[model samples]
Target: MNIFSLEGKNAVITGGGSGIGLGIAKTFIEAGAKVLIIGRNEEKLREAKLSLGDNCSYKSFDVTNLDAIPDFVTETKSNLGNVDILINCAGTHLKKYAVDTTDSEFLQVLNVHLLSVFALTREFSKVMIKRQKGSIILISSMTAIMGMKQVVAYSTAKTAILGLMRSMVAELAVDNVRINAIAPGWIDTPMLHKATDNDLPRKTKILNRIPSGKFGMPEDIGYAALYLVADASKYVNGVFLPVDGGAAGGF
Candidate 1:
């Protein structure tokens, strides 16, 4: 048997219309799984589906709409049958320091990154527990592991995700439902470029710090995510798998 094969598995990837989420969707589909990509942009989702082909599907839904999640989960299950994997990659970023950040902004960030994610996990893990099989991946970031400027809200949410994963594992592991977090380092995505393009010094500083000496590709995170949900990692549980190129551990 192919230990890495995800054949017959059905996956739901939030924020899968672009960047790392889209990369994960592509990898999952290539590994023989059916993927449903969700995001707030219908056009992007349509384009992603077109590129990913028939094995891929999509839904345009705002994750922050917490009340809509239950219905969304129900509809997804009805359409996709059983969700073998769920990826919480949907999030919003705020580039503001703590002093400048307002209460509304911080709460908004938490609502999307933390609250929505928990709701989805709670709803989906129930079905997985009943079936006694499932893998859930939360997309975390370097900010969660270390300090970063102008991303206090983002860091807090990501850090909380790790806590959420660890807490869920205690309950879900007994049923063979594994939940974990992937902390991706600086990736070569539009988001990264947007943060670095005009700030050459910052970009250089980031690149210099990474032992790999270069920014990582979105697929880098995808492959790590694939392993977490694949049969190869069945024994692994409640871990913070960092896909950063030694940046988190390096000087």
Candidate 2:
């Protein structure tokens, strides 16, 4: 057996119109999986699809719309087949001190990043369980591991996901469905640029923490996603792979 092959897989990636999500979609498709990406940006999705080639397509939907999840899952399964892999990569970032963070803002981020993730996973796991095999990838963050100020909402949501993954592991494993997470380090994306572009000191501090002394690219996470979902990692289940250039271990 080819350990790295995803040749007959069907992958669904959320937040896949741009950045890391798009990167995963592209890489997955290249690995011979048919990819259907979900996001709110139709134009960006179209552009992404064009670049990802014939095996790629996309759907436009706001994840916060909890009422639409069942239908979306049904439609996705119908359109894409059994959905061998599900990549939960959609989320928003809010930077604010714990005191300054509004109740509304915190809940909004949770609804998108945490709650919707649950809804989609619950819905998709139904099909995957019946098939007795599937890979579910959760996109976690560095904030989830290390404490960082001014991102209370984002941090709370991401940290909560670790709990979610652990709780579901034993149950999901019983049915042969694997759930894992990726905690990415400071990646060089427009969002990261926007976060630190004005603060050289902050950027420098972040870079210093990373032993590699450079930010990672989206494809870095993409390739990691492929390993988690592909044949190579069949025995791996519920592990959080931190693709952080050794940042997590820094002093």
Candidate 3:
């Protein structure tokens, strides 16, 4: 039997209606885990459910709505049982120079990327503590390690996630609940395409920095997520695994 198999595990993936979130959901389902995806778009959630088949489910809820997270978690647990894995993949990015960024813009990024993630994790940790076994994976970014132009707000939020992951690991590991993070480089997602649209020079510059000579596919992160969330990484904690194709290690 594969030790990494997620059979019988229940996972909750945020922002799971599309992009990296969707990729993770698909992979988890393939590994025999029951998935409950959360997103703000009902139509997208329905579409994702259709693609994932019966073993997968979804809920329409915005992660930014921190006040309702506990209730949402409660409802999900009632419907699907205790969640064994939590993937904080819900986040937003604002591409603008620091000077051009607004206070609201920065706050919005923090609200979704940091505040909401913390809230959801806190709620889930309560349950996991009772169970004494769980895995939490936060979706961080390469920008968290290096300075990147036109994404000051996003960079700040992503960097904060690393700190959050480490802090959670320190506190949660004692209870046998593992916490970690994944820092991805430029990935070939809709968000990346939108960010680089009509900016061939910027896109080319990013591509050149990646030693792999191409943007990472969603499946790359998916595989990493599976490893961390499944039994394969049961002992791993407080580590920020970079799925950046060497971008973080390059000049």
Candidate 4:
């Protein structure tokens, strides 16, 4: 038996049109899962679906539309037959310092990263629990575990995700529905380039601290996500696995 296989699985990945989410969707499709990728941009979603081929589908929806999530979940489950896995990788990054950050800005970050995540988790876990099977991966950040500057709002939301994962474990684990988090290190994604391209000092500092001496690839995170969702990791639950090229422990 192939313990790492995701055959016969149906997965829904938010923000799966690009970056780490797209990488995860690609990996899952390669592993024999039918994946539905969701994002706000219909064009990007269409492109992702085309690139991913027939095994993949896409939906254009914003995660911040909290009220629409329940209906969206129902429709998704109906279309997929049954959702066996979920990856909440939809997020936004703010590079503002705390002094300049406004109340609405903080709430907006929380709205997408924290609130919407809980709503989706709540809705999906209901189905997962009834079947006594499911695996959920929350895309956390390196900011959740370590400190970084000019991202106070982003950091706060990511930090809350850890607490959310831990607190939900007590209930979700009882029904065999595993929930875990992936704290990706600095990956070479457009988002990363957007944040670091002009900030040479910050980028250089980040590179020097990493033992691997290079940024991680999106597919690197994809493979880590594969391990967490595969049956091989059925015994694993409620853990935040970091895929950061050993940067989390660098000198």
User: What lDDT does the true structure give each of the candidates?
Assistant: 0.93, 0.91, 0.90, 0.93
Backbone clashes under 3 angstroms, per model: 0, 0, 0, 0
Candidate 4 per-residue C-alpha lDDT over 1-251 given as tens digits, one digit per residue, 9 for 90 to 100: 48999999999999999999999999999999999999999999999999999999999999999999999999998888889999999978888889999999999999989999999999999999989999999989999888999999888889999999999998889999999999999999888998999899999999998998999988999999999999999999999998998988998
Judged by lDDT against the true structure, how good is candidate 3? 0.90
Q: What is the clash tally of candidate 3?
A: 0
lDDT of 2 by residue, 191-217 (tens): 788789997988999999999899999
Q: Candidate 4: worst 10 consecutive residues by lDDT?
A: 89-98
State model 1's lDDT. Answer: 0.93
Question: Superposing all C-alpha atoms, what RMSD in Å does each candidate have to the true structure?
Answer: 0.9, 1.0, 0.9, 0.8
In model 3, the worst 10-residue window by lDDT is: 228-237
Model 2 residue runs over 4 Å out of place are none
Higher-lDDT candidate among 2 and 3?
2
Q: Model 4, 239: alpha-carbon shift in Å?
A: 0.8
Model 3 residue 78 lDDT score:
94
Better of 3 and 4 by lDDT: 4
